[model samples]
Target: MSEIEQLLRPELRGRTPYGAPQLDVDVRLNTNESSYPVPDAVVRAVSAELADELSGLNRYPDREFTALRTALADYLATQAGVSFDPEQLWAGNGSNEVLQHLVQAFGGPERTALGFTPAYSMHPIITETLGTRWVDGQRDAQTFDLTVESAVEQAGEVDPNLVFLCSPNNPTGSALPFEVIEAMLDAAPRALVVVDEAYAEFARPGTPTALSLLADHPRLVVTRTMSKAFTLAGGRLGYLAAAPGIIDALRLVRLPYHLSTPTQTVARIALEHADLLLETVEAIKAQRDRIVAELTALGLAPVPSDANFVLFGGLADAPATWQALLDDGVLVRDVGIAHHLRVTAGTPQETSRFLAAMSRLVPAHMMTKENP
Candidate 1:
């Protein structure tokens, strides 16, 4: 390592960086992005706005993001079915930036950030980037569910300052149960519980959102995005719902001019046509069901998922499997955890392409292990 690399934030010296694939495949199911395109109406609006943009480029963006914040607060309120004052809201380029602001505000030498493993891989990377130690609660290797007993034990053991729970947890599409969340709330009342509901819109009717529990849990913060079910991955908009105090802290840490005008306009239009976009979400959910059913028939053990992607391990020689799929113009993700692989739901044609690729890659023995 170079001398500078050695001296660099000691914790970050050799950490592997997050690497997203740079390819175009027939079925690009690696990242958990919606395969749907923006509604033609919204795309035209975005284009028109871009055309109308000021040539001045001299005046900085609205420093306070005042108008954008108002629009976002109103829109998310309807989507979440929860009320939030404008003072209780803020937006960033993406939820990832919002998360970083939280770390900058709270994570430091002694403060710890807590979460579960096999989470959004970005979680640990973000914690390490802030020089904060990451403490995680264990899960059943077979099923990625957390128990109240285990969560409480970790709270006492690690004493983390911030705890993140990704409901409809990423990579593995399991939703952290309400009981488990209640137990963690009981266990770590002092810690900030960040319930990341990035895929909440895909959740079934009875599943409760962090917003539902906020009435009783003051320290809870729920961050959501328009990228998943809203089909706005390219929009770069994410929001948070928390108590006034926590929101105030985030407001203090973030840059003055954050959410851009185009982002605000597009997000507003997306929210307006949500019922239409929800058709896409329903289609994706149906697509996920078909994929899961097919995966099971092919003898892969996909964990029950409430999100867009499903995960399974025991995939035969994962790198070889991945390469095999690549050869056939079908690509998927081999997130390193034994034979673990994650695949996203896409349009029917995309789904068929992925299934054909799977037929080409998986061997008999690994298929047996995945099933039995």
Candidate 2:
């Protein structure tokens, strides 16, 4: 092995960094990023805020990010009907960084982190990178659903120190039944259970958020980000709500001034204009539903989604279809499932382009029992 390779941590020796393909194409829906651009009003506001903060760049940013935390707490209160003190909120560059913080603080050598399979890919990466043993928990192979019994059984078996759960789970695009979160808390009493709600704003109406459960369960952490429904992916602000003590633990591991002044300024301004920024949510939901309807009509199995993306199965070869879609100036995610690919819900026009690309591949690429 090369000297650098020999010197690297054994756990990371062969591991690739997490990323989805970022191919340039007409309809780019590989990542679940919002297709809408930031509103002009919000853009102008952020620019103004940045102008005011420019003179202060010479000094270090607020070590605690107090104003940004307050804004996040206010946004959570108004959005989820749950009140949190600023002390109960913590943030990082993205949800990924916040997740790493959790692993760093609560996970380490000899501890274990458990996450259901085919959920967020970052869970295992973050766990293992922190010298924590990663337990690959299972979901239903066919339905991709996790039941309370299954989750509890796995938690009991592994007794993990950290548990990662994703609501409106990535690639599958379905929300967990609230009971699953509660059962995980009970089963893994010693574990810090993180519920990633990155796509919470896109969930179908009546879907419950774990934020409400936080008042009673101190171990439960509900993480959200401005990257999704807020349409601020470039802003790189993600946060979590938990007990004040749990939030305190994260502070111990986070780097000093981890959130810069500009990040704080942009996020606070965006939170102030939350309503205007979220105006396209309904339109995106409409497109999501449209993708489901159209894909189902074409005999593909699109998982019923509560998020901005849809995971559709019954493709003969997911990677091949991914390439075909890209060739046609459209792009979707081949989430490495054997017969499934995922597509983010974009504008009506973008959705139409993607659907049209799928239509062209139907008889040749789509799977049927007879063909199989």
Candidate 3:
């Protein structure tokens, strides 16, 4: 073994870092990012905010990120109808860092972190990297649904120290039933339950957020990111809402002055112009529905989605179809599912190009039988 490899932690010796391909293609939809660019007004506002803070770079940023936390709390109150005191909010470089902080605080040697399978891959990565045991629970084999019964049963069996629940889950693009969250809190009474809502802004109408349950459930934490709907992925700001006591626990593990002055300024300014920034949500949602409808019409089975992307099956070979689409200048995700691929709901033009590419590939790449 190489010197560095030999010195590395045994668990991380052969592990690859988490990343989706950042390919340069005509219609890139692999990652569930906003296809729309930041509006000119918000760009101008961020530029101004950063310009004003340039001189302050010499000093350390606010260790607590007070103003950003308040702005986030305000945004949550307005967007989700859940009021939160600033003390109930915490943020980090991205939701990933916030998640790591949670693992560091609650999960460590001999402790266990449990999550339903085919959910966020990072849940286990973060858990195991922190020396926590990872329990891979199951979802419905065909439908990928996690019922309250299944969740409670798994939690009771694993007795984990942390449990991850992803709403509008990645790879499948489906939201968890609310009852599952409640059942998890009850079943895993000793565990902290984290609901990753990175795509919450794109959920269909009438879908409820776990934020409403935070008041009564001290173990519940809902994480949201500016990377998806906020069109601020470059800003690298993600925050979560939980009981103030849980928030305090995270503070114990976070590095001092974690949020830079510029990062704090940019996020606060973006939150200030949230309405303008998020105006394209309906447009994106329209494209997401179009993808589902059109892919299904093409004889693929797209799981009903509440997020900004669609996961469709029925490919003869997902990797082959992925390459065919890539050759035609459209990029989608091959999420390691044998017969399935995922495409982000991009701008209308991008969606049209992706659909057109799929249409042309149907004769050779689409599954002929009902089940491939």
Most TM-score-accurate candidate: 2
lDDT of 3 by residue, 244-344 (tens): 88888888999999999988988998999999988999999999999999998988899999999999998889999999899999999998977899999
Q: What are the RMSD figures for all models against the true structure?
A: 2.2, 0.9, 1.2
Report the C-alpha lDDT of model 2 over 75-135, residue by residue, as the tens digit.
Answer: 9999899999999999999999999998999999999999999998888888888899999
Off by over 4 Å in 2: none
lDDT of each candidate versus the true structure: 0.77, 0.92, 0.92
Deviation from native of the Cα of residue 122 in model 3, angstroms: 1.2
- Candidates in descending TM-score order: 2, 3, 1
Error of 1 at 372 (Å): 11
**Which is the better candidate, 2 or 3, if ranked by TM-score?**
2
Comparing 1 and 3 on TM-score, the stronger one: 3
Q: Write down the TM-score of every candidate.
A: 0.93, 0.99, 0.98
Misplaced by over 4 Å in model 3 are none
Cα deviation in Å at residue 277, candidate 2?
0.5
